[model samples]
Target chain A: MSHANLLSPPSSIPPKTALSLSQKAPLILAASPTSSLPWPLSLLFSRESPESWTIHENLFLSSLRTGDDKSARLTLDRMTTRFGADNERIIALRGIYEEALANTPAELEKVFQGYEKILREDPTNLSIRKRRVAILKSLGRPADAITALTVLLENSPTDVEAWAELSELYASQGLWAQAIYSLEEVLLVMPNAWSAHAQLATLYYLSTPSNITTLSLSLRYFCRSIELNDTYLRGYYGLKLVSQKLLPLLSDSTSLKRNNDEEEAGPPPKLATVKKLEELATSKLAEIVRQYNAGKTGWTGLDEAEVIAAKALLDHGGIER
Target chain B: MAQPIVQTIHRDPALFWWILLPITVVMVLTGILRHYAMILLQTAPKKQALPQIRQQRSLVRGINLRTHAKVLPPASFQARKAYMVSAYQEGKFLADPESRGKPRPNPMSDPAAMEGMMGMMKGNMAMMVPQTLIMGWINAFFSGFVIMKLPFPLTPQFKSMLQSGVGTRDLDVRWVSSLSWYFLTLFGLQPVYNFILGSNNSATQSTQQMAANPGAGLMGPEQDPDKLFLSESENLEVLEYKWVLEGIEDRLVIKFGL
Candidate 1:
């Protein structure tokens, strides 16, 4: 399948409709378990496709999510029977089930203890280790969670999910520099992730107290993000916001003078160039809002709240300029 | 002894349509059938319990760490290596903690090992049974007949095997019986099978042999990944670390001239 098709449902099928269909899947399967068994089970027996496993796994997760613990347990049992109880994925699922069952902090603590015991026996269980980190974070132990996640990252540097989680944890702790570093690690693993680029720009923007250098760095990162994904609403929004903040700094020579002794936060773009880029961002944001507001087919994917916010910015920038 | 002049025998054209073509078609069909049969016979992979999975994947994780260590900085790699080596030595990731330090059970006795062997046996059987049956069918019906002449020459040693049904001692080895035609189709129809059933079809004997061979080790359940991990840990411990990103900035400046 083409990557675009894989990412988005066919244009004929709306995303919300597809989501509702998936949501209704567990209900249908729960209603007719026997009929569901024949097709996937027969496919399993025929060995025509291994995709049946993924279908079953999704069914299990959905069942768990919908509070149909009985069906969830059944699907889990079926998966364990097919794959074996020791399969890595099944173990992860079992951990998730335990997490779902733990209503009280005490019960969560018990689950935490269970994970620790399992980790003691098998220190390399990265999934369980991740779960332990999550439990620690939930239990208000950010330090322990950070340490655990760092160790996990050391072993599996390519784990994008863990890196993203660690970044969030660091961000929550107001460790801006560490959060930026962790997000950079995420970028290193998945350099083309435009979302991460925008996120890192946001982080950089938030880190310093309205410094010209930091604003410029944030602007460049936002531009890089928009360069990777042209249609990214958040990237364009960030670009406009950062540039608006930057334009005044560029015009004022005194604000820039304070940071002259420090290392240049990259080669600072010239004042005229910064002004031009800010205008470009404003124009792009206006175009996005206009297109999205007109109910254009392709622009339907743009967030309504963002479009409204952009419109407000355009109106606000009109008076300021 | 005096050498005699070569004598050419007139062969019937009817043999091509009557025997060779029929046998070729049958062999191809059997191959397609065997491919589907093998697909039907294949069992889904048995799932391992969480601890077993942990034990297997933890070792895998260590091996991955060792292999991809260059991706990490020196400090991180050192920390991971130290942890993995110590954990491996202590049997921290053993599926059953009580079973550690005890000698491994004979693979023959292990149920999982037996299942692997059974899968191999099934593949071998799938390839062999149809072959033996076809050979017998050809031999019973089409014996004592010279069907066609090969376009190449063979030594006198082949005469006993290839020309088995034909009692004529003076016939060239190239002028073989229908049974030899069966053997030719058996070995030579691999490409035909590939075309008919796709490349990874289990119908081909050569592939089955490759799977059965311990050196190829492509098929069958793997030997315990825990043991594999332990050995990998030893390898990682001994490996000389050379940090690839040691002077990354300098290299970048040299490349990009920024």
Candidate 2:
């Protein structure tokens, strides 16, 4: 049973058996260039604990098998330092990273940071800057976000959204002058910002010193809002209140007869529009109430005034305030 | 050539520490940290409406009257503030941008629109029913406690002031009632965000103009009235409840944007 005797016995063993053993041993012991280790040892140590690269390789292989590009890329990133930048694997990894950026907040933040770092290297990356602004705003840094947004707006003044956010930031701080300035800029660039016009009307009404002129501006914005969007509620709401304010004048015009000097002035022009608005307000209020009762809870911000306004239409037909 | 857009950036840890300490202190004192999100939403300026509205005013009224409502209240400042705070807690605040901003939809006016609005509102309410009910009970209980813990003797002047706005009984109950109403508003955030904030499918193009020119006027050069009016329901703005309620009609009808 000694080792030397066993070796010596190989020569004494059958010639056919020895030859077959030698041939088979060489065939099994052949090394693979692609394999990390020899095949036979690898098989023998199949249950052996794997290194990080082994585990990563296995994960990557499995991911490829499953056709999970994201998982595969992630495994590659884990294997390669700095995400395999400028390497063949980068394209695959970037796609996965971008995808992850959209689905998860944490991932998106990471991407933003990464993109920002890239921007530092290359400032002309408009795409990255654009995404950065959105993410920043979502992250709740309106002021800083505005700064980023302004970068895009400086070259493209017609950018409606930039104008709007700027206006919004100003308006939020009750900075009427700044908001108006911003709004005016928007109009200059896009001219069709009816919603902005309506906002301007609201601004005029809230910030204007005189209630009458302010009311007029309010009516103007309301009319514009309505004109722009006949179906929109803000315009109607404005029309309702504005009409109410002008109801006394409109009703007086209506009451004047043909014999009366006012009526003789061609049916008192403004009265027709006022009456139409009044009717619209009444019917609309009724409809809203019906909808609300039907489980159409309109929206969440109604204070007493809105409720009362709605109720007024629901209860009383258009009556002069 | 562009003067290096990022002229200087100091990522100084010392500077960060200095800035952070004061912010943390201020945040702690104001309880802002706890409710920073809500406060930011409340404080953030709402979106500017499209420009189709101005032309519409000119067309309809023969004068470009702004089509935005002036959110005013009959009550004094003190009463108004109190009402708003209470309303905010009650979740009745309805400042969704769809209905509040310029070029707002007149849900109550047109019969067809009313029907459509009703359908939309019901969907919104249905979505919010659970949240509304839960928040209502919770707010109601807290409101009751706040009312009950009235330090009558400690601040006679303040108590009298609160009573003076209206009858004591009515005024005392109003705060609690407002809290209950706020539950309705809490659920509106999602719809508004969806319709307004997420209006543009393409993020790059949606705010391209806004990004290029901060503080651009609402009325752009094109002044495409048709586009402004009856525009496709693409991008909408997210409005805060307080701002919406600031200039409300006597009858408030909120329409969730999404």
Candidate 3:
């Protein structure tokens, strides 16, 4: 059978409409009889009605230290058929569906059917797309997963979580340029995102085959990342990385002056920022050195800048030998 | 005596050079010049008998992390690049699958067809082959790329969620202490498999294996398939909180060979 048809089973699953989070608010409010149960748990176990079967399933789920496939299957069927088409029951049952699929051999695609039913109802749901992507990846359909993520992004570019997941997928696949590009998109949406900068720097440093221009841009992003979050260790380390290239430049007056000229040509604020960084690196090397000494582990690839800065401090006799 | 059928009516040397020489050259280049022209003409792209799986949310999330987004949200440039690559990759992945799946007739089968196909294909192939190779190479290279770049340099803002604390309690530090070597060893396995198995054949094999033995890639050896199915349907909270993580780990290893 065609995979699409397999997913869209002939079973009498109700067509989904809008899922009403507001309608379910009251159900979520009711507490379980046991005072010891957490509020989240209470919300799940308070009732046995079809309206609350989703919650009941969750309650039953929490108690099973090991997996309970039969109960899970029963809950999924009840949630799928009895609950309203536009209910979050399918969504709620997703966890159980995944577990059952993993543990049970026979119901692999049946689990897929539930997921498809959800998507068919709410195609734009980012969460649904995220779920679908996971299944695809697990099934070794990275390419298909990539497609779903792209579709999600097109609809919802601001979905930061989706973007992050997509980046990891690319990284796993060794698509550095694509990975680097995705990280940049994350920064575009959330400018203060320092880790994205740090990761971009890493991609350029490790993956891109020896392009000085890309390397320099990577350093520039790291510097900006540092400015955004001073405590960001990755940014400082990235600086050290570029410093390896900058070392020769720092010694060459021609390059130094050229850099100065380039800085001068740019916006004044950026140039001032560069001067500030130079001062910080010169003075703050001591604290970094102290931290390094205080810490047991020596360094990581991200720590190369601090290492360089410490070497400079030691060379200048800033710290007691 | 029968007259030799040497009709000189169509003796246009210019036309021969213009059409036949280039065609001959292309056919030789593609190495499929031996097949009959009629067969080549009749060939068409075969539809994939493989299952058409819409991206499930977990799979999407995994792909996002593995390929595009190494670092999670609230990170810095890593996030942006992750987004960009994802958008780009998705766009590529969503392109007409039929066109992608269509098998081009073996241009190398007939010298004329080979030459013609090569001439036309070379342009597209030149542009596409490197892009594809690079894409695959990037996927393999990224595991190390992410570790080298971010390596939990700071308590990434998201760190509070993954694991928290200021000085000694960094998750990356702990993860490094525990999993760094493991990651390093694990990281190369996929690329090595990809190198040996080749992405096209290996990816298909893995998927088939997963479908055949849904539990094969799962982490534990003594898993009861019946229990797994029952648990998945009956109890969701445990599935979400506990089994899902385990499931992802097992599936990733099987899928990526990580």
Candidate 4:
């Protein structure tokens, strides 16, 4: 059982490591001549289980991500043989493969045209439509991408991934309000997404320049994000930043009065409460950095960039006004 | 005469090899064939126009909002609910604005609905035709002989059915004809199908029959999606929103000992 468990896909493998592993898969598969035997005989003679297909799929996607087009093509051929070329998932994979193979802008345009042709034949092929949007975005056409995404969302409003993508596209163009709205739409579909909440808070913070009301709203969302996922270092970091920004403003009565006059303003926290939350963020972040730097077990999951950022923030004695 | 003694007709041991084995093997093979036949016969889902897709998905979006409303704050949730309610009432997302307030087309007469019915009929036929052919084949080739005895007793009511071909008047009810053996294998080969074909195979008739009912499987092409969306919007309107993140800070404090 332990051996079987070990042979299963390693859930802890980082994406980068997984990509490299998948890139090597074709070589491994080629080395073993028996790996390509017809499925029925392989099932009877070898220890091949259903998990092999999943591994192949992962290999296909990773190969594409790493720009190993040859491995990706081989993986796609294997998948198409197994599942048939007409299979919906296989068709989507083929589209992704073509997208990966397109090197030049003209090639990308060809892929985009191919997607449009498929979409005309079957309007419900949302995957193909999404690829088309990605091609447009890559082609330096944000306006066209926005229009395509909007049309897609109008048809499939509950697609959280599309909503998140639309939010990013909006954010890239400095359309903060539209980005925030799209992110809220994503939250509507998946409410407990703490990462999304933190993302939304970041958008809110970026939209305004030291506005007390926006900062207070950002602080609440950050708190909500950390509340949902207690170990979200980014959420904690946002909370510390917002609380610090709000602390100075809360102490000044004129700024507090100005915040109260704003319509739709989130309720500002008390000065003592903000101070306590800031202290909590500081201590938690310090502990995380110390443990992670010590190479302690269970703390290695913290992103290195985030820890460095937190360390730098602590060293700076918080963001100077 | 007093009550007659129950007479047992002993069947040949070769009956197991010839009659029982052939029937069981044929039943299993036919089941495997039927599963593949159904797979081959399945039609790909047809695409809908943009407006139609929008109309259906808008309703689903409303339902999702209602169900997952706890994930959003009160203000955001209220804003969404208000927008959805008004949109639904206004028929803003209707696929064909001209069809608004008109009577729904009859599911039987509609060509798309006819296609849906045909698909169901095909599935049922795939399940039924082979079964009848195999049963007839068994009756023709392997009849008028007692094949096996049941391990358990059956009441006299089953005597007529289980001993269909064999006509010995006073034979024990447990002494069943080859037809009964065919019936047993027909019902009992489900586990074998599961072993060979994997679970969720179309070879299993009971599950397939249950799924063949109009409302059981994926939304068939026959049903009016507009009506579905309208009803879903009504459901959404009555939902009471409660924010799950309310007092989340306290829970976090308790969890992390902050």
lDDT of 4: 0.78
lDDT of each: 0.71, 0.44, 0.44, 0.78
lDDT of 4 by residue, B1-258 (tens): 897676766668999999978888888889888887887898875556778778767877887887887776666777888888888877888788788767787777888668767888899889889888988898889988788888988889998878888887888898888888777778888889899878888896786776665432324455555566677678777887676655454544555665
C-alpha positional error of residue A307 in candidate 3 after TM-score superposition, expressed in Å: 13
Q: In candidate 3, which residue ranges exceed 4 Å CA deviation?
A: A1-86, A89-101, A104-110, A207-209, A245-321, B1-258
The DockQ figures for the candidates are 0.08, 0.01, 0.01, 0.44
lDDT: worst 10-residue window of model 1 chain B = B248-257
lDDT of 3 by residue, A8-97 (tens): 222222111012222232344343323345654643354443435445444334322224444445545545654554455466456445
Candidate numbers, best lDDT first, in rank order:
4, 1, 3, 2
lDDT string for model 1 (A287-321, tens) is 88888878787887765666787788788752232
lDDT of 2 by residue, B13-34 (tens): 5533443343333323222221
lDDT agreement of model 2 with the native: 0.44
TM-score for chain B of each model, two decimals: 0.85, 0.18, 0.17, 0.85
Worst ten in a row by lDDT for model 3 chain B: B240-249
In model 3, the Cα lDDT at residue B11 comes to: 36
Query: Per-residue error at A208 for model 4, in Å?
Result: 1.9
Backbone atom clashes (below 3 Å) for every candidate: 11, 88, 112, 0
lDDT of 2 at B72: 24
Per-residue lDDT of A14-127 in model 2, one digit per residue for the tens?
A: 333334333332222232212355654543343333243444444444344344555556556644642356433443344334633465677667877876786676554444
TM-score of each: 0.62, 0.31, 0.35, 0.85
On DockQ, the stronger of 1 and 3 is: 1
Which candidate number has the best TM-score? 4
